[model samples]
Target: MSLLPPNKKKVAKETPRNFVIFGETMNGKTYFTEEFPNPINLNTDGNAEMIETPSINISHQRDSKGTITKSVSDVLSDVIDELQGTKHGFETIVLDTIDDIITLFEQEICEGEGVKSIGDIGWGKGHAMLEMMVRVLIMRLKELSMKKKVNILYISRSIDIEENDVSKQVPSLKKKWMNIVNGNSDYTILCRKIGKQYIRKVESKRKNYTRDKIDDEQIASLLDTVIGAYEKSKKTDVKDAKKIVEQQEKQEELEQKAKRKEREEEAAGESTKDNPDPKQDKQPEQAPKEVTKEPEQSKKQPTARRRPPRQARS
Candidate 1:
């Protein structure tokens, strides 16, 4: 009764991807994001002047007295609202350098708790609050991907980590926040500078990065390839499903024919038993007797009657 193809795993429909693109400073992390379709950058690092892509400056709000009114988190919420409420026609939304955004969030947390630094908060609650705030932001971006079909790209700088004397690069965020970002994102690509050429690490294998040459024009080709594979898998599933259905139909037809033949044979046997052929059931005929000529005797036989009753009366 299943709707999926026989012996084939079900594949989900293609949707926009959320990416965490991280690399060292000036390694083209922000520049590569512009290759996505119809992209707009949420410029938080004050580097919007360097990029030609459309961007919105995300900054804290202040009053005339220089007292802080709105936090960066609040401004991000407003941006999400505008994207959801209005038809912005933007296909991709980039958070330019999420490292700066995290820093702003930490500052906002410190200001709210009246502390000089995040560590001053009692019982390590400040870190927990910051993590929650970042998680909320990621969830909101996911909503945009779901409801509006928008792709989200978070840009960050990579920090090197040493483990077992092997160095590896990861996003420039705290371990807890980094885990959150990587878990929530569909892709965690690394931009590396190999000599003068820029290459992107699309996948990782046993500390060996799978590199792909990228430029401003073809940075988004990975997404295209993924979507194309999805389409091909879908078509294959449909074809397999149709073939299975046809096979089931043929098997059923054969079964029906067998049943019909069995029924006909039973009917013929019953008819033969009910009415047998008369010629085959008839008894054997005897020879006709010959009539012989005989002499006429003409003598009548006399009968002796009983007269005992009359004698007894006399």
Candidate 2:
């Protein structure tokens, strides 16, 4: 009836932490992963350089000229190799924006089925293909994360979902990629600006045990905490990466100071060949130290005895 079959095989629940973010443009999504090593940014549809995160531009790997140059299957394989063979020392993976990925999918469908566009296609075949592509990507990303101990982050623009109470359809981005993103992610956040305040709310879901189980409030506040990371694990808040690097440099500075002090002390204590000892030079003219003693007591015994004897004779 449509383009392709739904990937019913369960998505592997392997990655430690998967974060999905939805916010307005320039709300610091990319900045959140800056601390990660050079992440492979699957930047399909957005201006990536603006984020200032340490990421590589690989949007062109599959996307170019308004369509995908490589088949989706081939593209997936290539991404796996790139993740395993990265030189950037990255511990995280990111989708800078998924809005553009849908565009790429539409183009890929047109290219594969020989149509000019999704709307021009005979039926909803393009939508089917788009769904399968999203499912495959999510599953693959989860597998890679588990195998490599890498984290995954997906950044997106915000949408509001109103509850009708009777029949509620949540406000969200265009459905093709949006639904898949929503369904797959363990931590989905909605970021909005209400006046001057920045608010982040957890997008609640009742995913079964097949996926990671987390409550709405927990998910939202968890996202709020700078990803509670351990130093040994290199799990760090995306914002704290720059600070960590600075601290490393400071430690190096202290080590250098200690070495400098040790070198100065050694030089000062060393005997030099330039001069003779002061004690040797002054030996001839040196005066001996003077010593003084008190005189002995005088004897008065003889006069006393003569006076006593004369008195006795008288």
Candidate 3:
């Protein structure tokens, strides 16, 4: 066959792949995975029986005192075997809690060294071994998504921490392994309760979905909504935006009215100084005219006095 150009690669539709769902306990993390198409759960905590569905407890072998018997490599091999099986009949594979899986990796390291704890491998070898195990598992899980075309969901619990004086809810993982878990997934969602309802919040996208509160029945529809929202939806509330705009307009109008009133007052003051009142001018005119009338009265007063004097003499 002739080689095809890389630019002529076939186009394919993107579907949901890997998701990390984490929050407080009993917040529907497991139930959300149940909504997916035919899921096989790897229950490390042995709570799969609480889900009311068929599940496999992959972390089974333990001693009478509850010591882990399965090695990390063994568990990884079993999961990959199921992924390769044509008769496995599972489209989605879920790890109940990635936190516990990390613990199992530590146990595997201790057992290999014939020690009671990973701390026995001193000089930082324990940390190195743990990190290597985590990376190997992360690589294989990614393969399940890309090569095997299977969906993977990792469930974890949330914890609170202060970053730059602001408290935030983040997945409860050790600092050494937290970044790996966070950076490896296609989506990281936060599940929580709001009033009488539960919600799943995607922080980076500023979006939330109503979780199933009444029954597990709504999980189906919620899953569809979440998967449909590959592209982000708007975050700003419309009502809040309209309120902000109205407040700005009202402030502008008030400022204009104050300016207009100041202009009117200034204009009135200037007009009064330029043109004196007519009534004020008339008052001065009447005072001067009364002074002129007094002189005229003096002229008439001599004839009246002459008549009175003649009468008195007679």
Which candidate number would show the highest lDDT if scored against the true structure? 1
Write model 3 residue lDDT over 1-314, tens digit each, in one string: 76866776664434446778888887768767787777888878777787765676756367897666766567777768677766776778788888988887787777768888787788989979889888888778888777776777888888997544578888887766767866766567787776767777654322332333213333335454453334446567999889878877886787799899999999999988877684776555444444344433444444444444445555
| Ranking of all predicted structures according to lDDT, beginning with the best and ending with the worst | 1, 3, 2
Q: Using lDDT as the measure, name the better of candidate 1 and candidate 3.
A: 1
Ranking by TM-score: 1, 3, 2
For model 2, the stretches where C-alpha displacement exceeds 4 angstroms are: 1-16, 35-38, 58-76, 85-88, 119-124, 161-172, 194-197, 205-314
The superposed Cα distance between candidate 2 and the true structure at residue 89, in angstroms, equals 2.1
lDDT of 1 by residue, 115-146 (tens): 99999999999989988999999999988888
| lDDT at position 148, candidate 2 | 73
Q: How accurate is candidate 1 locally (lDDT)?
A: 0.76
Whose TM-score is higher: candidate 1's or candidate 2's? 1
Task: In angstroms, give how far residue 240 of model 3 lies from its true place.
Answer: 22
For every model shown, what is its TM-score relative to the native structure? 0.62, 0.51, 0.61
Residue 271 error, candidate 1, Å: 99
Encode model 2's per-residue lDDT on 1-314: one tens digit a residue: 89986869864543235667767665545555554445667666555665565444444344556555655446655876887777646667787666655566666677778888776766687777777877888788877766776667777776544222243323345765666776666556555556765555555532322213222333233344432221122368867988878877886787789899999877765633334364665558677788777776677545644544445554
Give each model's whole-structure lDDT.
Answer: 0.76, 0.60, 0.71
Mark the regions of model 1 whose C-alpha exceeds 4 Å error after superposition.
1-11, 14-16, 203-220, 223-314
